[model samples]
Target: HLVLILCMFLYINSVLLFTLRSKSVFCETSRYILLYNLLFADTVYLISSSLLYLLAAFRIKLTFYMCSVVILPPVLVYSVSPLTLTVMSLERFVAICYPLRHAVIITIRSTGVAITLVWLSSSLNIIIRVLMLLCSNTEFSFDLQMKDFCSEEALFRVPMYYYFVTAYSGIVFLSAGVTIICSYIGVTLVARSASTNKASARKASQTLLLHLFQLGLILISTFHSNIITAAATIMERSHVLRLHSLSFIFLNILPRCLSTFIYGFRDQTIRPFLIQHLCCQLK
Candidate 1:
């Protein structure tokens, strides 16, 4: 059942990704380009994460190196969603608030540069985490089979490493939340302007709100481990197992699938094209 759900969402994301690149308009626009980056990152994360989940479910204990290979990429890509979202919010803000300069500020070349920076920054953080994990683990070895279940928590055994992750997650989400909120406020103020296009402004405002909701889902997915741990303390073992499975679905799978609906259904331009492609694929 779980595999079925993951595959279904993966198929939807794959279709939406293809739809975005199917036309020149989607390729040329700054917002769609950013959406492509976001969807691509989310898709990668979903694949890696689902793989890890299946590994754990089957009780397949991986070696230290194998665990890192399976888990670290998801961690790296995890940061990309929020960061890409921040960029997307800023793009919308510019489009509505500064309509005249939106073109000059957010070009195709600049969007490419922005995406490059996002990946570079995320890679740097993961590299640092791995280096620090190595330095801290005196007995760490490539051949070491994991004693616990394979997850991020299994790799981050040291106190400082966990602390560093907590701090980094806080900083990333804090900055992202603030940027999205500020962008929403800016759009709202612009909507009140006498000369602003009321319909466009309203749509942009709703989009920004959806971004916030999506960010919130991403935020929940990140802290799901903590939530499960806390709940296990009070619940029976059987209940905890059930709760864990539920968390994996709602927190992990559902959040990643939402980007498709939020943009695919909401954007009129993409809606018809996405529907046509989906129907053709169904047939």
Candidate 2:
């Protein structure tokens, strides 16, 4: 059932991505381009995390280096969602608050640069985490087989990695949260202005709110593992495992799935094309 759900969402995400590139308009629009990047990262994250889940379910233990290679991409890519959301929120804010300058401020070139920076910053953070993980174990070796299930929790057991993850998540989410909230407030204020186009302002305001909701989902997904660990203290092992699986579906998989429908259905320009592509109507 879990595998089925993952595959379903993966197919949907792939279709949405193709729909985005099917037209020049989607490619040129800054928001659609950002959405493409967000969906792509989420797709990659889903694949990696699902692989780890399946492996753990099958009781397959990987060596330290192997697990690191498989899991590290997820760590790097998961942060991309919130950062991209922050960028998207700012883009909306500029569009609403500075209509005249928005085109100049948010060009195709700048959007590409922003996406590049998000990936670079995430990569740098992952590199630091990897280094800390290595240094935490003086006896660490590439060939050491993991006795425990291979998950982020297992790999992040060292105090240094744990502390670094905690701190990194705090800083990233706090900054992203602040940016989104400010953008929401700015858009709301603009929406009230008689000078602004009521329809467009209202739409942008709603989009910003959805972005905030998406950010909340991502934050919850990131912390779900920790929540599961804490619950294990008082719960039976079977109950803990069940809760873990449920959490993975609701927290991790569902949020990534929502991005497609949220943006796909909401935008008129993309809706028809998205539906056509989704229905496999190549004509």
Candidate 3:
């Protein structure tokens, strides 16, 4: 709990400092707007997870309403984050591939709309997920206690919806994964093929690599735990607990923490200010 709290504090302050220092530059650009939203989403996820961990550690019982309101929504909304990454990657692809027409193609308003749509679809998907679980329970005449199963694994165990939810979610994951991979792959190819600007091509490859690294981390962190938690016999309690702890730190915390820095430093617009802030703090 203390660790999570410290992380949240650092993450929030870092974002606040960055945002406040670059308000004009950040608020003016569509790419920055999407990045800001992504960061905010991560911030919310961190806070909610921290509170949930704190409560669990204290053995506090969260009511169905409380879990639904506090826990599930944030987790569900967090699913939108990878989708947001895909959008950002697409933005980069357009910029790299269609450099001459990038500005005209991806305007500020269109980017906002894209981000908004991602959130909307994510919410609907989550809603369907919850409803499916509830409907399945009702159909099977099983007790539907939303509060009982706070974990994703428990949610999947809910009878009738199990297969459908798994299938649907798998499809959603695959779609987003494909989109991100494809976009970055295209950017990498375009960058490599350009003979004139070797430096730009190298930079593009670097960016794609970062995107792929983050994507792989997110997928493993998000889905790998589910498999681990499901296979009860594979890991002993202590081992599972240790793995969970490590996952919480590396998968949940480190990736998000690194992403904010990557987004801030990767964009040339913000690099100068970020460097200035870092040097000032070092002094």
> Which scores greater on lDDT, model 1 or model 2?
1
Q: All candidates' lDDT scores?
A: 0.90, 0.89, 0.67
- Cα lDDT tens digits for candidate 3, 43-137: 77766766665665566655454565665756566667777777877887787778788889788889889988988887787777677667665
Model 2: worst 10 consecutive residues (lDDT sum):
154-163
Q: Compute the lDDT for candidate 3.
A: 0.67
Model 1 CA RMSD to the hidden true structure, in angstroms: 1.4
- Top-lDDT candidate index: 1
Candidate 2 accuracy as TM-score: 0.95
Candidate 2: tens digits of C-alpha lDDT, residues 108-227 = 999999999999989999889877777877888869899898888777667777777778899989999999999988888888989999898888888888888888888988789779
Ranking by lDDT: 1, 2, 3
Q: Pairs clashing in candidate 1?
A: none
For every model shown, what is its TM-score relative to the native structure? Answer: 0.96, 0.95, 0.81
